[model samples]
Target: MMLKDKMRQLGRRDFLRYSAAGAGALMAPGLVRPARAETAGLTMHTWSAAVDTVQSHLSAFTAETGIPVNYGNSPWAQYREGMVAKFVGGAPLDAMWVSDSWLPEWAEAGWIAPVDEFDSLMKYNAEAEDFCTQSMTYGGRQYGLTYYTDYMAFLYDEAKLKEAGFDAPPSSWDELVEQSRVMKEKGIAEYPMMLAMAQESWLIEFISTLVYSHGGRLVDDSGSAVMQDSKEGAVEALQWVVDAVDKHKIVSPACVETGELAGLKSFAAGNHAFAMVAKYRLRMLNDPAQSQIAGNVKQAMMPQGANGSHATVGWMRFHGMSTQAAQDKARAENTAKLIEWFGGKSDGAYTFQKLLFLDIGAGFGVKPLFEDPEIRAAYDSYGDVNMIQAQQALARKKDTITPWFGEWNDTNGSAWQSAILGNVDAAGAVKKSADLWNELKDSY
Candidate 1:
């Protein structure tokens, strides 16, 4: 029978068998290696950083447990689409890397298995708890395991700030504006800020931080869209970005056409004085091969809002088992073991640090790793003044966990982008976005 025809006839048990068979075929060559004996053969789909961190450490895992790892790497944008297709097509996959943002959608679609069954194999890290509450939870049940976390912060050129006569970073938005104005007048920098307004994801991130810092929620307790247009604070936040571009003139004109990486490149090249960027970019700025401001970079919390509150964006990446594999149970167990071993201390947080530097996701998922003096000093080399402060900011930030319905990104993120890019007025954008959000909530 054809694959699709077979899929229609198989029961869950048979489907599991078929899925594992396909996965086994994919790993047949690698299975001959003695190290894979314990796993009964498992395959994983992950992004590049996982290859660098976890996959690179597979030999160690084999030495300890005798289970070999079969891993594949894909780009971030393709990982989700690939998994969704496989799940819906009834193809077997043992486990794959996923984004926390995808949990609601995938869980609701019944595309993933709950990781709670493997709780005994996993040790809870406080950092993992923080990620769980913000990224992996849906209606109080955990759907996946998170191994990485990230967020955006204000990155600046220390030399430029000092030349502009500022001894410390700005404490509030008003100070940021003032500092930017001075830097502009002094010609210390051509543009005071480098933001990726053109990149939709980055734009959403930038606006989300502003909205939360101003005491706004992307969606209310009822899971209905409420903040963007209805809240005064939300409107003001958008207006702040508008003013930065039009009135303050502190933002680069290139922001209109800049992609996320370009914004980082601009800041690192010293073409701009400051940037609102992911914390991991700090490492890039310190790499002399990639940065002109290698020794002059510094990191500070996102500036406080009108209410004296500062908010940051919490981004996370997760791993989940695919229902499509032949050896479903063995695959799930082996994948769990991999996560626990790599993220656990016995591996020495090697995967965690590599994730941060590679920008695979945020590494703060392991909190104790941040507390390590050696780690902190290395991050400090990139101007992470008191690493704990960045961690604290991430902890305090509002992480609005929207239901991971497939349409959530299309509805909410697109609407917010419309407002940020001037495609829709603030009220119009919010109303349209909220309408779509409420529709999704009602369906739920």
Candidate 2:
């Protein structure tokens, strides 16, 4: 949720606005190799600072395998295009971070190399494997290793909810709206809900999550944008977003411009009561250095839809080898060794779960790590209830990557914002969006 760096419609303009939210907050690397020999081997690419901070860990890999590493990073906006060009041009990068959304096209185009040979190296746990199998398997081949995962949940103020006469978070849409009403009336919070209604990638995350919650989906089994076609589900889902912003006048009008940072700050400052946010964002929300609401905030599942939306609408980022790297035997071996060490290979026991996942809120896709008794006891434990409950909640309802997502995102974003702003009706906008989605597929 922090590093949007979106490579879609509403493209580069708003891309940088939210990507760096958790930058520089990662703990210092702890690679006690004591041998810092420099070799010009292994170039890894990622846009986020969280990955950047872990560069020193390469020393540990180098110590273990004697392979010196070069860490390369680009501005989030250019990382995708830059890497795509590198892949097409055969400019070798041993390993690089790849979004789940980008894997389909890259793998289809043969830009990324299959990692089936290194399968044993990639397994941290079942969840990690599941993420890779789900995302990296583009066309009968697995091309990447998942390192980071982001998922959504509802983060609400316990004190604020209590003041509103509710001891627990709302479970359904009606309950949420009524909770907001009481919170507003009781002066617990003027706007109890803050969503990323802006036109950037934040909008995509929020829109899709809400859409999924209403039993609507953006794409069908055939990888077509079908939300516009599911009128009962999509329209109602979008109308709730509109009603929350305008008709009910519960959320601030500024929500139209608000992205993740704005919402996080607002919720942190106690200006709002609930934020439909990614579990990773708790790094900021519960940080003493970053939030006034830290320690006071608690999590709940997103308010349910009429049909009950169970999925969190997630995006899992993985690391993949360039086909260029795969062609060279020596480079390929070095790359695999480097990836196994850096991309979350455990030390038999004592997996670096907290180091990799909790510190930056993005790390090892290991389900067992999150459920680890020790891990739960040490950090994720929030009294009786642990946090893995929220993290596991992040699941996507549909594959977001398609030739049409950019257009779909652009059209869906515009239509939804228009409806929310009262310039168009939700029903009409969604109907048009569905038609446009079909047109986009044909154009492709």
Q: Which candidate is the best by TM-score?
A: 2
How far out, in Å, is residue 327 in model 1?
A: 9.9
lDDT of 1: 0.67
- Across 1-444, the per-residue lDDT of candidate 1 in tens digits comes to 799987688899988998999898878996545433444556666776646566656667778778755777777767777777767876445667777767767777777666666774344535454644456666666555565667777778889999999999886777888999999999988788887766455666676777766656677656656665545356667667667776888876457578788888888888877888877777888789989998888777777777636666677676666544323666667767765664444455545444444444345565556666766666676665475355444543234455534565556556655665668776776677667767767776
lDDT of each: 0.67, 0.70
Best by lDDT: 2
The residue ranges of model 2 lying beyond 4 angstroms of the native Cα positions read 1-40, 51-53, 122-132, 349-353, 381-387, 390-394
**How many clashes in each candidate?**
14, 0
RMSD of each: 8.9, 12.9
Task: Give the alpha carbon lDDT tens digit for every residue of 201-305 in model 2.
Answer: 667778777877787777677766666654536788888878887776678878878888778888889998888887777667777788898877887776778
